[model samples]
Target: MRRAFFYGWVIVATLFVVNFATHATGNMNLGLFVIPMSDEIGISRGLFGWLTTSRTLAAGLASIVIGRLVDRFGARILIPASALITGLGVIAIGSATNVVQLFVLFAVIGFGGLSPQGGGLLTSVPVAKWFVRKRGTAMAVTSMGLALGATTFVPVTQFLIGAVGWRRAWFYLGIISMTMIVPTALTFLRRQPEDMGLRPDGDADSRLGSGAAQRSEAADEAVWTLGTALSTRAFWMLTAALALGGFAAGGGVHRIPYWIDSGFDHDLVSLSISVHAASAATVMLAVGILLDRVPARFVAAGPFAGFSIAIVIMLSADSNTDMFASAVIWGMSAGTGIVSQPYLWASYFGRSFLGTIRGVTMPTILVATSLGAPAMGYVFDFRGSYDLAWQVVVAIYAAAFLIMVSVSPPRLGRPLAD
Candidate 1:
């Protein structure tokens, strides 16, 4: 009975929809636009890559500001505004006539992609506040929407571009943003369970005296302030992992061009991304449930491992089958990144200040991500192949994997007397 009616689940459902729409038209989808834009505008691929870096820098900067706003104001105002702004930004991209215009517009998208309430810490932090015992499950379920969005949107957008053109395809994204996202945020999103007069995990107040309630409340108190959290060993360790996530997963991840260069047609390449997203969506739910039962470090190591192996596979692929296989493997690692990274924070430091913690850590994630696409693009321009760039990615993943496995529970900022 308790499983069916929790309002915390309402936040989960709402965020799932939010993430779905946000990511469907987000950075990941930028892959679909690259060839079309280059074909029409005839810009250097190396120059085209700067757009990803610019957007990453903008989003990183905005995350710091948005993090504070989220902690202070809650999702009530932030989420809706992000929807409108992000949707308009996407629409504007269709009208861009020059590289400067595209850069400016993508910056707008970077802001809206994960703002005070759109994605990342914004969504995860609130859900974290609303579910102590079920934090992993909640974040996992919410993020799965991105996988579903990517799964459907990539193929659909590909088809849209084929039928109508890339400009019309982007207009559809703007329409989707307004029609689907705004209502969901306004209808179901809340700052906390207390706003609706309920306890976290949605237990009845009548049970306040019960042992279960006491334990849940006690667990919630075991959290770190931003200052306290910063001083911990685990903070640096985990943040490092998240940073590498940008380079390994973030940099130059637009595999469409790489595949297109390898001889696959656009439609086949698009299907590979769909398979990747399908696998990612599958892993998010599975890993969420897995983290609830197993140690997070155990599950975390696998992402780096999968990523490294996938890069190796990409280097050897001579057929569409190999491309889909490697893409699917890459998707598995991405699932851990989007889903497990937050779970790691709440598990280690608790969620009381996740917004600020992730806010402070956001730039580290972005700066590395900012370098990734351009690095790959330049490498391709230099060598006419992604083999070397992908090999370099594998090496980084290897180091990150070792770092992840070496992690132990962080020593507290103020340890008890020996």
Candidate 2:
């Protein structure tokens, strides 16, 4: 008989903790410290922005090597070590006295907090290894920690900054990071279910039969490697769609100023953001379920289309109601990419070599993501309004939609020797 409980759920729970803690420490809660830290340390707001950029760039650079490590040795060694590195880095930031120090510390956080072993591509790869048919549901559940972390930890960080001061606040966050992340990951994480005589989705061996079970344990479930995956047309198409969608999404990300500048009350704008976050969370699970049911290309196309529509609504919007409606759609659209991209990577390429494939694709996606908001900001600087930017963003989304829908899954094959 199948065990009453599968350790795969335990893996999910471990990753959930890792995601929650690393996200809070990595980027989400850093905004809470910007004003206080900047004022006290004598840095401009613009200079402070570079800290995030540094973190993102460092993570992108580290992904290639980390991805290979996760694929080889598994998350067991890397995740805890990443947590330890991130925790210490956060703690060290408490002592930073200059921009150089801050930049170095943020880069440390990037390497530790945002790598495949820690936050961004962290849970997806490990979860993909443990579950196939249930991969969507698994990713959805684990990713919920990100939203929850933002909700819970941002306020906590703000409170700590207020009560203990900014320096002490970093100390506390680091402590929490090390305490929560390292132990859970070390205790529960494993390479794959088969490592422990379990199968993906916790299916009994008898159900798979001998051949399917062997495939599940070996190359059948994971056939493509970095070289073969890179050789496919589908991989390039997906990367292009991801880049376009990221850039398009960035155009709308700074829409708060558009509403505020147009005379919407700050309270209304804040409420709209909440609406967006709620909608995004709901859509994540919805997208996950759809991934299990529909063709991934179709599932992936929905977000690009939804985002385009939301932007079109906002560009012509004249009132609070229109903005709120746009927020709902915008949030829903934002949710699909995070969950689906990783799922499609695994589903199309197979779980075995997912880390390496994701690693290679991550830098491109990260560059697109990092550039999106600033590019929109740049347009607004010259034009004085978001009209031109949003129009361009809508066009970008259209291209992404077409590219996404046209993508075909890659055929399974052995990877060539390096």
Best model per lDDT:
1
Task: Return the lDDT, model 2, position 367.
Answer: 65
Q: Who wins the TM-score comparison?
A: 1
Off by over 4 Å in 1: 1-4, 113-119, 206-219, 411-418
RMSD of each: 3.4, 4.1
Error of 2 at 155 (Å): 4.0
Residues 324-344, candidate 2, lDDT per residue (tens digit)? 999889777766766787888
Q: Candidate 2, clashing residue pairs?
A: none
Model 1, residue 66: displacement in angstroms? 1.3
Query: TM-score of every model?
Result: 0.92, 0.84
Q: Determine which window of 10 residues in candidate 2 has minimal summed lDDT.
A: 113-122
